[model samples]
Target: MTLAHQTLALQTLGLSKSFGGFRANSDISLCVARGARHALIGPNGAGKTTFINLLTGVVPATSGTVRLLDEDVTRVSQQGRVKRGMARTYQINQLFADLTPIETVGLAIAEREGAGARWWSRVGQNSAVVDEAEALLTRMKLGEVMMWRTATLPYGKQRLLEIALAMACKPKLLLLDEPAAGVPEDERHDVLDSVEALPQDVTVLLIEHDMELVFSFADRISVLVQGQLFAEGGVEEISTDPRVKAVYLGEDAHV
Candidate 1:
């Protein structure tokens, strides 16, 4: 309860969510310090995704306080939350198939910054917005295929595009749901780096299955098991703890 030194960017106390007879999240509490790279790891059914839904207002929290920058956001709607500088990406690729990659990213920037208000007015015409979108594409490593239709790009590019879209919002914190999932094994490293390279002021809370990426990126790690928080610790402590290894790491020895 005492968060004096915590400098929490986002915090949840005694959070829970239920669907009919099933409890998706139970008494889950976490504090992500301002600018911290926090990673959440768990087995397949641990309710990691559901927890994110509750925080982002995609689903209402059954009971709890959700705070952003020390201000309560438990009841704020999703769209309102985005305007307040919260953004996220999904497990599945979410992009406009018919639009060119540049156009799609352009729309996201416009939506977030209100620069793309004139839809019928030439999308690729705004010099400032186009410059910003192109830079984002380059930073996210999607420059080579900037002109390709989103649907035509490779899976990895599509995934990167989603991140770019989130960045357009200029969010203070980004919630990434399994970013490396479905990305090629060889390309996972770069994708992880792209995430790390994001603005230091932008805190990240990610759900990831790749142990190597998780251990390398997370400043802190929290384990979820059967819809409850099993443990929370700094990177080294979580990686070495026997209980964490038993439940989440399994046969894979700690890296």
Candidate 2:
């Protein structure tokens, strides 16, 4: 493989998916470089979610290939992909309301270590796991409420915890689906800061409708329109592209 290929954290070739009579994703070939902060944006029905599902192996593609860290993972199961260093957070967090952030993250860490079966018995007893969970939660800006029940924390903190849970797997590629969705305006900054502060070694692919977050966090951007790639470029290029403004971003959109 070429050095260029070696540097890609994720790549999809002609990746497409369909359900019954509907085509949710067309043939899409995209690349995300190692440690790159890439954003995928589109209109409401532009199929961004379906594309994320395909990447995470939550939904199988009708055709095409998915490669994670340069290895073919097109046929890998969702759990298989996680084992191979690919992790994702959903648009709507799937957190355990009754579990504390520490417990949630601790279980994730244990699962990554192949000790999930004994996680309940080992959570507090395993100093290594506990330490790592604490450290991860703190990094995600949930240190102050690490012991609070998830349902009681603010929405933004809950979102941060979801990211923290994904991080526990030590993934090479992290897919964040709308980390700022449903957050109060005042609390949005916490989500932004936590995402920006993520380690450079962990490449991030963000799918968000919030333009402000996309512009702030993404160095590279891809605009998907009607399930096909409409444009791809650096932030300035996309922000200034007149066609993008016409179709997705309103004419009055404040780039």
Candidate 3:
């Protein structure tokens, strides 16, 4: 898993963001190698979310450069980034409340396949999109609830559906913003397993607050505090870092 010679999915050099006199992110420089499971963690107000926004082109950086697949994309629009194999989920699930998991994912599949303009007319009649949607939901272990309305599903299942929706994009690099955020404790395992089983070739960068999930899922971690990279290393290195302990994890963090 040494990334030294691996191809990079993303590289940000001196990336920063500021609004008026307040600097939300400062000089973040990091690399996410192709197929790497990377996590960015920090305390509240640590600027992790801000950095994600900058990385995904939802917000422009005040300074720095971003390269995706070694191609400079510092100025790419947010939609433009999605076209270049970047996809993301949100801290809060963005779902069609009334749509069944199958329908929701079918729309995404249809969209990705360039049939979205006729989505309403294509539903139920399009075997290809329907079959693809079923396959993805099954892969996420959501087949049992494929017909359930998203709003009526358990919080955990809702999260799983969102991930499935993101996967429908067939992204080479996926960014997950707190995929496990609101799941009830009893159902967390399902969400965790779905993420663990993502295709090996799809690189992931997640912003999460769940330490156990972070340590278990990520191969590499970057700690950002006050919008700057406070620490970077393997799980063992970060788990033992005194500065990280004091700044983000506190004394109770297992690592």
Tens-digit per-residue lDDT, 1-255, candidate 2: 688999999999999999998989999999999999999999899999999999999899999999998899999999999999999998998999999999999988988988889735745898899999998887888899999999999888998998899999999999999998998989888888888888999999999998988898999999998889999999999998888888775667544
Give Cα distance to truth, residue 25, candidate 3, Å.
0.7
List model 1 lDDT by residue over 103-130, tens digit each. Answer: 8878878887776578587867787888
What is the TM-score (0 to 1) of candidate 2? Answer: 0.95
| Model 3, span 7-89: residue lDDT tens | 89988999989988899998889999899999999999988788888878988899999888777889999878877888889
TM-score for each model: 0.92, 0.95, 0.92
State which candidate has the highest lDDT: 2
Q: Give each model's whole-structure lDDT.
A: 0.87, 0.92, 0.88
Give the range of the ten consecutive residues with the poorest summed lDDT in model 2.
Answer: 246-255
Error of 1 at 168 (Å): 1.2
Best by TM-score: 2
True lDDT of residue 24, candidate 3: 94
